[model samples]
Target: MSTTKTYRIILSGGGTGGHIYPAIAIANELKQRFPDAKFLFVGAKDRMEMDKVPQAGYEIEGLWISGIQRELTLKNLSFPFKLISSLFNARKIINRFKPDVVIGTGGFASGPLLQVATSKGIPSLIQEQNSYPGITNKLLSKKANKICVAYDGLERFFPENKIIKTGNPVRQGLLDIDTKRTQAQTFFELDKDKKTLFVLGGSLGARRINELIEKELDFIIGHNMQIIWQCGKLYFDQYKIYNNTKHVQVHAFVNNMDYAYAASDIVISRAGASSVSELCIVGKPVIFIPSPNVAEDHQTKNAMAIVNEKAALLIHESDLEVDFENNFGQLMASAEKQNELSQNIKKLALVNATKQIADEVEKLLKK
Candidate 1:
């Protein structure tokens, strides 16, 4: 309970922003509650977290680790060596830092670090953002003291006693998007009179989603809607030509997502864990185009949870061609449908997830 006790904490996660940002959000919440706490982030080397964690004003260390490929490729051949090296480095880091507790948000780097931390009898917790657990988190669950999760029915994978339905940690900026709607519209230079569609394809981008948006721009605009499309950095060159078109604005990446969400009437997004969590808070009518390329097809599973609740709609990649126009047209034609989706999705939002996860970590620190 003492703020001046100087607790040391280590957060490890990130092959993608889905894993990275949750760890950062938890760290930020913990920092405010314990101002003198020392924080260190552990992430995979050559990953985005190396750059991102530092930008968030924390020190970080990277391990020589990478996830095993699903196929029997050359990358899988290096798995053992990488694992051993990462284990050694993780032990060295834990020994030197002497953290009060360690937390993981599910990534390859977190595997070795949390393994080492638990072996040393350091109290530890892992946060699973998806409804289905990842392989790393599933393995770590045995030794992990607590498991923080976002969805229901995760007990099939994680130990029920260890599970806490803390929901996924969303960035604080997204919590109150309504207040920023007017300012966001001005920031994006969107016409207040036109209905807006916001397209998100994660940070790197989704090729299939980009193709759909490009192919359907004429159809969407015909429905009296404007577009704020985040085609992703990888596909920006291919889609930037649409930037000059009326009723459309394209960006490589959207840095101001709070503003982007605030200004939009409808959303078309890939169903990554963080994106789903943020959308639940933003509470817009969403048509999820979940990526098929992820491990275990988790994105589809993430979208289905909300779809079943009537909180959002789902259109798989293969169905987009045949189903996109009809589904979209129906939603656009009905204001009542949009309001229903918005209200249902908002009911699922856990605005205090960061604080709740941090509360679990604080309990570990106390013990």
Candidate 2:
């Protein structure tokens, strides 16, 4: 007689593409491996995941949750109510779903849901994409079955036995770049003759990155460089006017990032967990401009981890205005620099990370 096992998983994470994308990638891997698995996502009500998760072909439930305001504000008054409401809602979801496993990828919504799941004796796993774990992941570690980390030396935060160094999972398209360069150049309708530069500032875009790129558009082309700039959604309309007579392609988000990465000779972008992970897979020379506005200055730390290894370059937010164009042009002209960064970064690629994590999940499920 043939028998089948049904698995229920409660996946949680969001607040930004950095957290959302990695969670989705893991979910996709889990789905592929376990066709009988039932998956449910827990995200904050007003966040992007409510929309993005559904778009990724998954069902999601929202909690009336948000981060505690760092500064004294009226939202602080709502903090107690939000936490209570989220915990209450989380308990209801856990009771109803009866998830065999809960997975958190570091976001505000993950805090209560994973906590409640652990309290209920459900196996939980956390995929931490950064060098530093956040308060949510840190708090959840004590109860997590296995904590998969991308960056090393995370034992300071989580139990060593509970931790495994499975690197972050990146999007599938980004995993291979061989045939995509010509395809990407044609997709963006960019010229194959000129060296192309792509600028990405994460999903919402970086204000300082956008401002400097907009103001220095002329300087970019004057160096005889073609560009594909992801101006981000908020600045797309405002930056669209510059597309009139330049080799500049502007996008709010590049759906075909594989092609984009293949077509680009140099990248100007932000330093987020997923972005950094994908960049390592792309194995391209990057100039990272981390947003100073993030929590714990983790973006800078993420970028520096690579820069320290001679695998990528970093331009502080303050230094971009004075140094970006000159440095980018110099790097482009220096084939040696590009090769060094490319080869060194490729050494950091976790090509099988998604499947590795899925294997871990299966191991836990079997146990």
- 107-176: candidate 2 lDDT, tens digit per residue: 8899999989999899989999888777878888988899999888999999999888888988877876
- What's model 1's lDDT at 130? 88
Pairs of residues at least 3 apart in sequence or in different chains that clash in candidate 1: none
| Candidate 1 minimal-lDDT segment of 10 residues | 1-10
Off by over 4 Å in 2: none
lDDT of each: 0.92, 0.88
Among residues 3 or more apart in sequence or in different chains, the pairs in candidate 2 whose N, CA or C atoms overlap within 3 Å are none
Candidate 1, residues 84-184, lDDT tens digits: the string is 99999999999999999999998879999999999999999999998777788888899999999998899999899999998899888898899999999
Candidate 1 stretches with Cα past 4 Å from truth are 1-3
Clashes of 1: 0
Highest lDDT: which candidate?
1
